[model samples]
Target: MTADDIARWFGEMDAELGGATLFLNETERQLVCSRKLFERRDVRYLDMRADFDQLSDRQVLDLTKPIPRVQSVPVMALMVAMYLGFKEIYLLGVDHDHFITGTYVYAFDLKAQRGKDDSVSSSGEILTSRHDDFQSLARLWRQYRVLREIAAANDVQILNATPGGVLDEFPRVDLDAALSGR
Candidate 1:
């Protein structure tokens, strides 16, 4: 079934909160970027409110497989989003800043990144408003790079959503239509 089809099925489940758009990610960038891109009236969150995995696992046990050696918080969050039927899941502020200190960071691929932990990167969009955080831009950049590839094949649409970022690797998402609940 397609993402929309899954969404429709999930909607019928008793635990759903209407036809809501959920924000599943960490603080800093993903929160800011997802909010901007996945703009909708009932933008629910999965961070503290509800663990995406726990929210609906029976629906995704078949989809989310544990990445053996991969460990990025943004990527993990992305996995959770996918589990919850969020096909068009956007990694808003997921900039790959923390990976730069390591030389093998370049080994990160889209489907399965090679990082040791959740310290990926930031999107720098929301951080744009906070100048002091400028020093942390590199990590977030790398995150966008690897995440772009993983998201492509999964039927999930990952976009940068920054005002003017090129994202030579990822595609820009059209939020206008997706958020309309059409």
Candidate 2:
């Protein structure tokens, strides 16, 4: 999700979940802080860049292992889960292939509509864009390869349960089969 999506979701989530934890990278933190959303009492902000464990080449990512630098926030989140010692990590909605169409599968559509209504869309496509950079998406695929090796070394099973997703680094399991243990 984009920074705007994070901010908007943070507000909406606050109403339903009551002060949920929100993860932010530097750019996202800047955007949220500038809007004064960073000061909210119901929200706990995690600076992903600063908070994750840094691993060296000899280190592994596990409950006691440090996380190596990754290309995306979702990867960092996975690392955190690994640090928490989850035996199986099932990934859903990881539609990495949408970069081919220059769109995100989980786009901030309602937010986009509001922006269009308020003329925010007219400012520039780049400013309101939710698409990942083409090169960055390619890099993300490479990062997933490394993550797969790391997960295996730690005896953690990373299953790609996203049907039709382009991520083929991990074993693909049908969502129903994964949930039913079939």
Candidate 3:
């Protein structure tokens, strides 16, 4: 999501999310901090630092420290969940197929009114803002493997509930079955 989108959502949902804590990476925090959303007394921001290329073999369970980044926000989020002591994490809509699909799409884009120039759209246009080179894409897969290792070491089960995708680092499960504890 863009900074404007985040600001607008916060403005609309500020009252309803009174006690929620928002976690953002340093870059994201900088993007939305100027909007004064952080001024809210009830809103707290956890500034997570990103480590772009390096993959740690062990789990980084400390929320106060920097988490290793795996080129995808979902990986970082999984790290946060593990840090928060979640034993099982079910990943949904993590297709990780931007290179194959040649476009960036968000799950909420169906509800958003986007313009032609919008970076995210349902039209499947290639995003010009950021391009992931072949090496970077390869690194993403390697990072996922490392993340799987870390999850195993921590005894955390990482399940991929995405219908079909290239993210095979974790075990695949049916979303309905996983949700119903089958």
Candidate 4:
């Protein structure tokens, strides 16, 4: 649902699926091109990349331009929340500090996978990972700010409930406070 790469999973699982398919961008690209050639009338695709010139001045973020590259999936999730008419959005565990430690939470065998083509970094070094470097980290924050503007344009509020996260763009609230409707 987030990108074209995952669309094939829907087709592969469509045989046992019962829900509607919602893809981003072109529906045909997301479907009918995979190995199974899946197609359904219930499938719907939403294209949020309206031309920057056509959008009102209030909608400041030009997602179509692809500038200030987004480093996290939460950006897309936030946009989807806006489309779904969510007025209050709270985030948790959306940390971008994995680079600070030069390791991923899932990379349990960083030593064994060092220098592998698919591994996070070359030379088997874990401390020099640049994925979370200053520029990349800053981009994540800038993208979140853009999401904040977009949310405001749609009369929505985004709160960062991520405990101790480096992200300081949005107002941070306690997770319990958010969940208790306080």
**What ranking of all candidate models by TM-score puts the best one first?**
3, 2, 4, 1
| TM-score of model number 4 | 0.60
Candidate 4, residue 48: CA error in Å?
A: 7.6
For 34-124, candidate 3 gives per-residue lDDT tens digits of 7776566443345455553554457645767665545777867887788788888999999977767777675553332355345445586
**lDDT by residue for model 1 over 1-182, one digit each (tens)?**
44343333333431434555543333323534533433433443333323222332223323333231223455556555666667676545443442232311332232222222233332212213234333344444444444554556566676554334333456655455446754
Measured against the true structure, the TM-scores of the candidates, in listed sequence, are 0.31, 0.63, 0.71, 0.60
* Model 3 TM-score, 2 decimals: 0.71
Each candidate's lDDT (Cα)?
0.41, 0.60, 0.69, 0.59
Best by lDDT: 3
> Would you give me the overall lDDT of model 1?
0.41
Which structure among the candidates has the greatest TM-score?
Answer: 3
Clashing pairs in 3: none
Residue-wise lDDT of candidate 4 within 105-178, one digit each (tens)?
53233332334434355543345446536666666676787777777777888899998757777889999988
Ranking by lDDT: 3, 2, 4, 1
Candidate 3, run of 10 with poorest lDDT = 109-118
Q: Give the TM-score of candidate 1.
A: 0.31
